[model samples]
Target: MADEPKTPVPESPPAPAVAKKAAAAKPAATAAAAGNDAKLAGRTTTAAARRPKKAPADDDTSPLMGRRGWMGLAWGAFTAANAGCLAATGRFMFPNVLNEPPQQFTVGFPDDYGIGVDERFKDTQGVWIVRTESDYTHEAPGFYALFSICTHLGCTPNWLSAENKFKCPCHGSGFRPTGINFEGPAPRPLERTRIALAEDGQILVDKGQKFQEELGGWADQDSFLQT
Candidate 1:
């Protein structure tokens, strides 16, 4: 067998000029990258400086809520409570008039009820009676007999003699001497009654029927009492 000859390693060719130039520029490229990073960092810092800081809605040491806001909340609660209370109280307490109003009710002659103003008759039905001065003996024949119901509300009415009017106890409705509504929430006059003269010369009023705008209450002298 012939002795094996050893193969020698081939020598590398000389680097190209362009390749050497690229190697030399590596450091400059790295430096340029570092400079670009530095410039980016500076720009970031400038932008942060230009942006405004966020502030709080209220003073630094003050509470988040204001006094007015608290007071408004409190008043709203109170008003709601008051309204509930009133609604509860008005639920009951009024009984409608029952049975027929009393009849054959006696009243004094006009001599007693004249211009003097509301002389509550001396009878049970006349609990809150008001009489005006004017003798109905042989005069112009104008008279009235009415229930003391308030025109504005359902409360009982009272005769205000000094003021010469009938006034409601509830909401201040008023009426004239002839039972005519004159003031306050009254829409009409106090209802007048059906009247008659009894045998004993006493005036009797039928409280059942209500007559409005009558010049004179029922009065027949000769047929006063039953035959």
Candidate 2:
């Protein structure tokens, strides 16, 4: 019984097959681990790149302040407005200061107001009415009326019956009773109002419509009055 040659048994082919399968499985596991690691790195990078944000603060943006500044603006506007009002008032009141007070009003009932020829009446800041008996020519026995003020400085004028003229006490300005400025600073004759006859048989005169120193065109109607 010599040691028969222990047969060198042939290695099983199944062993190599098993080893190849395990090697393939190892590669898959390694690839999966690498993929997981890459994903984790991406997340870390993204988080690190982000920056923190800031919050808004409340700020005061108001215009209320400084009482003195506002007061100055108000005062300036008020003064300008006051000046404008005064100027406007002057425009309306100027006539009163520069012109004579309407007086010596005439109510033209030539017969009632008619006196003698060249008959003069003192018209000192008053209204007068005249009526004539005869149909005097525009210049004759007809009655005339006028404001008794010195046309120059608005002084009340007095009529002198004997002289048949007007005299202003303020400045010696003189005028013929017929309303002519003969010697005076007056630029023209006394003012005259619009005169007319009322249906009631009385003469009507409008003192408010005092015409300029010139004889009104209607003043020529003195020939038509009946007292």
- Please give each candidate's TM-score: 0.42, 0.42
Residue 81 lDDT, candidate 2, scale 0-100: 100
Q: What are the C-alpha RMSDs, in order, of all predicted structures?
A: 18.4, 21.2
The clash numbers for all candidates, in the given order, read 8, 18
Candidate 1, residue 183: the lDDT equals 80
User: What's model 2's lDDT at 163?
Assistant: 82
lDDT of 2 by residue, 85-134 (tens): 99998899766556665532444344565364222443442643343444
lDDT of each: 0.62, 0.60
What's the true lDDT of residue 20 in model 1?
Answer: 89
Worst 10 residues of 1 by lDDT: 218-227
* TM-score attained by model 2: 0.42
